[model samples]
Target chain A: MSSKSNDKDLGVRKIIYDKDGKPCRSCNTLQDFQFATGKISAKDIQHIKNGTEIAAASPQETILNSKAYRRVDPPGVEELGRSSWNLLHSITAKYPKSPSDEQKLEMKQFLTIFSHVYPCNWCASDFEKFIKVKAPKLNSREEFGRWMCEAHNEVNAKLKKEQFNCDFWEKRWKDGWED
Target chain B: MSSKSNDKDLGVRKIIYDKDGKPCRSCNTLQDFQFATGKISAKDIQHIKNGTEIAAASPQETILNSKAYRRVDPPGVEELGRSSWNLLHSITAKYPKSPSDEQKLEMKQFLTIFSHVYPCNWCASDFEKFIKVKAPKLNSREEFGRWMCEAHNEVNAKLKKEQFNCDFWEKRWKDGWED
Candidate 1:
């Protein structure tokens, strides 16, 4: 089954192969993967070939260097991650204030399937694990919103990013912050 | 239930109320609603208050005028839409070349719930209608990718945007365009 020629041609797998020939989608944060994918620039590929440790550069630095990147190609994994989170959080914000039993069950089912089909293989696996340990809290809008925020913080922690304060999640994601 | 103060304070609903007092999320495209929610700028509000026909401006014009927009707020619906499509298309690209029956079932279930909970209420309703008429084809990667492209085109057609050709789906999404 793994012998499909198109699988090798997919580019993402070839770009991040591990020593054992396994595709290592989780080897670096999503931002670094974007650089490796050539979504940013050929300069990054050149850096990788020269062993210049391009992955060490911050995501902001990479973006600053690639002003033309947005026009040239579709979004890489970082863009995907950010966008998916925005959608998830926005949906949670709009969740019914007092959800019915059916609503709760539907939400739980949705999160479970979302983790399964998420494009980043490693990220999906991690989310699967996270949900298994702490299933979605879908009884009410606030509960679901906080749960989503915590799930995001889990990913942020894994990526060595600062943890977002869950207390302010509604302000951050739904209501605009008060001055 | 209708008396809930927070419901009106949600801003999204209040900004786009129709004659029947329903929050008409579909009254205008998501991009226009973003201006109403202050995701773009106060300048847009000023234009609206002055009866400058701001809604008549194109999306590109709105985006070009919002350089400071990102610094102050969460993503508006348009940004969320773009990001969501990126993730969805990428996931379809990576769907198994020959999916197992279980995998196909899981993908279909995901799409159904995704349509229900997607944050853009109008978009979600439209998708629900689309999927009811033409269910997701999940038997193989090619089928799934083509189905998604067609689904997206349906949305593009509604928004009066140009339809993307599905012939180059893999190149436009999964693989980078050949130089």
Candidate 2:
């Protein structure tokens, strides 16, 4: 574990695969991510007798080892994706029915910056292409929200996740289903 | 559980506690969120024999029962928070070392819209206050990243979680911590 050079320490790298063929931390599951970043080697991991060997091991090693998520590690791809979608859907849910020029511009800029700076390079590239074709329907909240739903469905289709019913977009994203 | 009215079906309600003293689904853990959303009543939850009782229960009953998250429901507050932070930190991690006037403006707009339309109303309100006190320091990626670190630290302090060392924000957020 050679320390990063001073010049490289503060610089941020894109969330992509490493040259060694390991997936980036943010792009894999927590356990895979731990392996990806060399936190635990494939050999050592297979042999990890218990949590005592884990670096800076959490007190509740049993729980941490058993859980799919650990608080100490950064989120992986699925987690990040879900979060981004939640933020995006929630935003569009409240988008004004009639937005001002500034609001529209800001919204456009937000999406632009969002997809551009999205950490996962591969996901960002796909998102960039997706936005290019779909073109944000920014005229009104309804249009924008509908567009977002369709966009989400497209991703869901590609991922083999069930297509969410677009009709319930607003209800699920903004309004909780009435019981 | 009478279904919502026709007029209310498509409406997106703010994420908040319900009149029945249940926290909104997005504000609690999966089990608590489930309880809150009436998917499982408190009594039933306490007495549930198996996954059969879960609405459209997943096949992995034991796994679903013990896990902190479920795919079927919207993200809870903590999940939402972690995801939002991933998006925000990653964005700033790549923000240009020195931004253009337009870039600066867009960044500011992004934060504004982000806070304004954040899904968790209570969290949003606190975020708004945090930003107000911190005021986004968006001159460059370095400044902005530092600002974000401080902002996150403030939240961590409030939540009683340990404060992340800002010095390594880039290493963690963008570049994988050097292994």
Candidate 3:
């Protein structure tokens, strides 16, 4: 195909490759994964054009958001992104104050495996990079929570969202204001 | 506390205790966490009374649904439940068929840690029980996916929701119908 046709075919999508160098739908939510692969609905296209909110339309009640990272019928990028953060953050929020060495080691292993098995290859690598910059602080809940907050804030900044004050990490994650 | 007052305070919520036996907000969304602890808005109370759809009130973008697990501010049981399944199911959906022994072991280890660090102690224990009943089958993607689907379906059944057709697991998770 001509370069122009290829560009036309791709539209605004940036193809992310999988282990086999094929377009990885799990990796690319918008470009290569969602629209390029014909996963997005016409309504989604309208939302993208108008910058409107995209609705997550999974009827399986998860499959609860089970396929969030895979297909539009199931979830797609936004749902996966939304849900993964929830699971990851909550896991850290509940980390023990003084985790045992084995616990710490397991946490490390979990993150490593998590980064590998995460459906979105590109996202998995990003998480790996995020962990590398400042390794998981497993000494105490406070230390680990702080590390996790900073890492999340970095992600927030990248997404152009407001950064949460890390000081309230406990209140935000573990305790509500009433506590 | 008077038994009558205690019951009144408990409201329609079922308090699920943590490891310490204290009311685990992580486990009980309605009883101990969201409303009993005063996390729910007055509007939420009205909705509860009216049986309307409950809104997940987190403007944090994520903390993409992170605190969906631990707190109502970020997310709550509903958010957490929805997201966890998404993350778990997608991971399984993407599992490498004929995975190396190392991958299977890692997946198993991942589940063990996942259950351990899971914020909701009740849910975590329940997940452990689920595993005990039908251990994870890791030989192939289909086997693993089928096992995961059955597990999720069991959860759905418990929640009084419809069971997913296991045959459609791949279609629902990895590929949309158009493909």
Top DockQ prediction, candidate number: 3
Candidate 1 vs. true structure, TM-score: 0.71
Decreasing TM-score order of the candidates:
3, 1, 2
Off by over 4 Å in 1: A1-15, A18-74, B1-15, B18-31, B34-72
Task: Indicate the worst ten consecutive residues by lDDT in candidate 3 chain A.
Answer: A1-10
| Each candidate's DockQ | 0.27, 0.27, 0.41
Pairs of residues clashing in candidate 1: none
lDDT for model 2 = 0.65
Best by lDDT: 3
Per-prediction fnat values? 0.52, 0.39, 0.56
For A23-79, candidate 3 gives per-residue lDDT tens digits of 565666643355555555555766767878776543234333344323335556667
Q: Write the per-residue lDDT of candidate 3 for residues B1-179, one digit (tens) a residue.
A: 11224444335455455565455655665423555455565567667677897766433343433443233454567678888988888888789988999999999988888878787777787888898788999999999988888988888888778777787787777665452
**What's the CA RMSD for each of the models?**
9.8, 9.7, 5.9
Question: How many backbone clashes can be found in candidate 2?
Answer: 2
Residue A93 local lDDT, model 2 = 67
